[model samples]
Target: MAGPSYLVNILDSNHVSAPKGSVPSTTLALTYLDLPWFPSAPMQSLFFYEFPHPISHFMQTTLPTLTQSLSLTLQHFFPLAAKLICPPPPLKPFILYSDGDSVPLIVAEFTGADVDHLTANYPRDFKLLHPFVPELPPSTMSSDGILVMPIMAVKVTVFPNTGVCIGMAHNHVAADGSAFMHFMRSWSSVCKSKGDSTFLDEESRRPFYNRDAFGDPDGCNEEALKCYWHWISSWRENLAGPTKEISSVDKVRATFVLTRAQITKLKQWLTTQCKNSSNDSEEVKISTFVVTCSIMWICMIKSQENDIQVSTNGDDDDDDDTFYYLLFAVDCRNRIGFSLPVTYFGNCLAPGIIRAKKSELMGAKGIVTAGKAIAKKVKEMESGALKEAEKGPSNLEEMFRSGHHVAISGSPKFRVYDMDFGWGRPLKIEFIHIDDGGSLSLIESKNESGGMEVSLVLSKNQMDAFTSNLAESLKAF
Candidate 1:
């Protein structure tokens, strides 16, 4: 197998900021919800769009529009251009923005690259897509030795007459997926309007910056911070390690789709299974999301069964009793008992976790078992989004060591395909960060056919097994 042969030529690199005086100097405190994700990796995404025009045309026209609109968009989303100020120990972390703060944007061109293959649904070399995204600038030390990290960076890579990819890297602590998608749509709207934002409603154009909107009566903020410090004490190397080098492992990324009809079939099958089961009293709230995730969970576990057994040295008793977990985030903007604006920014996500024994999840009733567990966890969230907020960090660490776990990123409701920057909807959107193990990204289908797209990265052998398992499961449905 040949290594990635494409070369990326850096065309320009510069910083962009909001218009002078448009955004006042600000300091935003990190909420308890944000602190846990402070040490995690930055969220990286690549949005590909077809651009069947010459490079000269792109430079002469598209480049200026993108850069200018981004600057204008920052006037409204100024926090994205802010720097995260991490003071040592007892001092809490906060985002700071003053005069002259700006986001780093890089322009590049990929030579000898196939846009079609990169945008295809089939497996492709994971490393080949890395260069399209810009790396966040290295964290700097303040005069007092505090860590100062940029929150976001942007890169635009042109495939020269084939397509263009707008890549972004943003600190997850700065914003959750909901907030990030809001910024994306806002930026695209501005670019599409050729730098006019008046077309958007005031509520849509600006984010509510009041951190006080999120009430934390339980002192979860302080507790969450304690958890962060405790976790970081053991990972001192990762305190400023979001810029860690990309993995060198041989991996391939592939996209799979579950159409509306297929998802319905899975739901029907689950209903029938529940009706026939001895434990029919158990309530499983079946939905498109539940069924899709349930089927994926069953297939993923079956696909990796051999590897799990080998890692456990074929300890049948222990292996059967071992637990596998799935974690996903739920947007809490509306769920929390507060009148927070839907546009209120920062992280308002509650962790949704499901744990199932290996034997249960791999059984013939795996989908039913997984669905019941997931639906229960989600139902628990309805009582209070942050019901057990303080234990999140410790719980997350335990799941990581459990050896069999998966984290779901993005969401079908994001409507990522609706983001049109005058060039049209994105041909494909890839969540670059999911290449890290035990993660998958989901988004709405590009064709507006009410289907959902799931993307993940795996080794060749694992991908083959996953494909086979998915086919078999769907056939059963």
Candidate 2:
């Protein structure tokens, strides 16, 4: 059975352009590091803002104010308003930001829903919230067969007397999470100042567009292209039939909160266990991210193992031999040895992977072992691993082809909580595009407390098993 069906009325839809004469027409080249994520899923985020006043107050006052401020902010972020013009291969794609470039902004009204239930700290059927998310233009294959992508889209849904939610769909290649946060913060600044153009600081108002500052001494560009093409070729060959969309009926999304006390205890446990287990030169530094991610990673693996155990009637020796990999994106802003501008706009992230066996992860020292493996990868970043990032995730692709793997979607360092658009700080931030199996999202807790909120996506059965395993594992801490 389903809950009450909410009604969504589209009140307005129009393109909001950058202020006239404010931004110049320009083209920003897409780097090799950015091109691999070209066809990847668009990063989606939903921000809920609650107001004590009536919904009419938001529609009459706050709505227009936000629109004008957004326009002003877009004047500085012109690339986001432009079209991603991709040429047929061997030629790289570039953003064509001409004068009068605008982005689509949608305003809608919702009825027959409880904003409290929608914004609660637990997971509900995603369909209940799906209507609030506006659909972006899909990527198109042109007559000449080149893929054209949309850079960004926005939607604002107002829930009558309760609150409003802002939905954003952004292409991953245009900007990493840091750049995305920069744009939102700038918009919030303008709105807070009552549409003042100068409210943003000089650093926040400007985005550095130079690609050569990355110092790619080796020709990593061609290597990246080769890897990307190989992936596309393989995908086409393997998935030639009609693709089936995943049924939301069998899936569930949920957020797990890690309190400061829990995090401290987890770190202490990992540190003690790590010291006893390894004699490697690299001492395991158990940071909050390392410890927390290690526990979740181990729990997820255990849940999968339990599923396997049941399916095989407890006779599958092959389960012990399964290889698992943890892949995460490392932001290279501070890792490249030299300093790039704090506001560098394009993608400057490198993919990193850590390998482990399922049996090891489900073992007694699993959390410590996983933490050490992640620590080793972080060390590579400190040692100038960005130099090799343009080659793409070489080992990750092979592992994805062979067996089991889990990937982290976002990092905890992104200041997502600072985005205040005058109404208030966001009540929650959710990554809506995390559908692939074993995918998890990490974001700073919304309470501004020094803790983490991990969002997991899994089948109903897997989620039930994961929560149980997570509870048992935390008992030691």
The top-ranked prediction according to TM-score is: 1
Across 266-366, the per-residue lDDT of candidate 1 in tens digits comes to 88888777667736466767777788788887777776775556666876455678899999888877665655677878988877878999889988788
lDDT of 2 by residue, 20-132 (tens): 88878898877776767755767778888887766678878998899999999888887888887765556667788888877898999888878878776565665556676
Clashes of each: 0, 0
State the displacement of the C-alpha of residue 412, model 1, in Å, after optimal TM-score superposition: 0.6
Off by over 4 Å in 2: 1-4, 139-147, 199-201, 227-244, 315-319, 387-391
Q: Which candidate is the best by lDDT?
A: 1
Q: How much is 210 displaced in model 2, in angstroms?
A: 1.3
Residue ranges of candidate 1 with Cα displaced over 4 Å: 199-201, 230-240, 243-245, 278-282, 308-318
Find the 10 residues in a row with the least total lDDT in model 2: 235-244
